[model samples]
Target: MAKVRRYSSPYLSDIAGGKVVVSCQRCGLERRYDSAAMIERAGDVSLPELRIMIARAEGCPRADNVYRDRCELGYDPECWNGTRPKPTDVP
Candidate 1:
């Protein structure tokens, strides 16, 4: 099985093989990522980029219409992976 890590900036390969744990701030929806489907849809893109583009597009978290979908990667906070990404890291 592929390794799942929780720290910072993940490469395209990370999401491509392993799983990404994501949760919503408003509703607290947690789930793993479907790498195969993602690759099929968006080709090869980094996890951070993937989050920004297509991370959570599954609509409302609870479907109660209480709060809008504010889905975000539970582990990642902003762009910095504990330490800021170098210029080369920012594609």
Candidate 2:
């Protein structure tokens, strides 16, 4: 038998081996990211944080007011392991 790893969190390092994908229902956009690369650039940020960062980088209207958090970033089912943090879940 072999041990298996699970990515039950939203941290970049946790999902590094699997696909790091996020999609926005409101914006109608989906994006895939290189987890290793992102970790190098931004350390191991949580999905909520990453959502805000992506929203800002991609010019999402809700990026300006993260408290309202209209970015709606959700993990694609193909790589989902746990309940994805909502936009307002950012720290």
Candidate 3:
């Protein structure tokens, strides 16, 4: 008999406001949620849960389009000394 590993879905209650943002490593499109909207929807739902729902509704995983980088948590590879752009001072 073989066992299968099941993955659990992320919920809104698992994240906080001002913590969720969308960024694409391929296109470098970064976007953040509106603070006003977060406040308005903070009564009965969590930001992470809402994001997951919206991702599903949009037919994509937030981790795929929004946080597709080193990991689902959005850790930039360059930050860890990987082959990416490094911060530099421009004249």
Best by lDDT: 2
Which of the two, 1 or 3, has more TM-score?
Answer: 1
Residue-level lDDT of model 3, residues 1-67, one tens digit each, is: 8433232544333343433454456435444454346545653354445544444543554444553
Model 2 misplacement above 4 A: 1-9, 66-69, 80-91
lDDT, model 2, position 6:
46
Q: Please, what is the TM-score per model?
A: 0.44, 0.65, 0.32
| Full-model lDDT, candidate 2 | 0.69
Sliding window of 10 residues with minimal summed lDDT for model 2:
2-11
- In model 3, the number of clashes is 3
Q: What alpha-carbon RMSD in Å does predicted model 1 have with respect to the real structure? A: 12.4
**RMSD of candidates 1 onward, in order:** 12.4, 9.9, 10.6
Steric overlap count per candidate: 0, 0, 3
Candidate 3, superposed: residue stretches over 4 Å from native: 1-7, 34-91
Better of 2 and 3 by TM-score: 2
Candidate 2, TM-score vs. the true structure?
A: 0.65
Q: TM-score of the candidate numbered 1?
A: 0.44
Worst 10 residues of 3 by lDDT: 70-79
Tens digits of per-residue lDDT, candidate 2, 1-91, equal 8434344455777677555778888877777677778788887777777778887888887775756655677767554443565344558
| Positional deviation of residue 68's Cα in model 1 after best superposition, in angstroms | 15
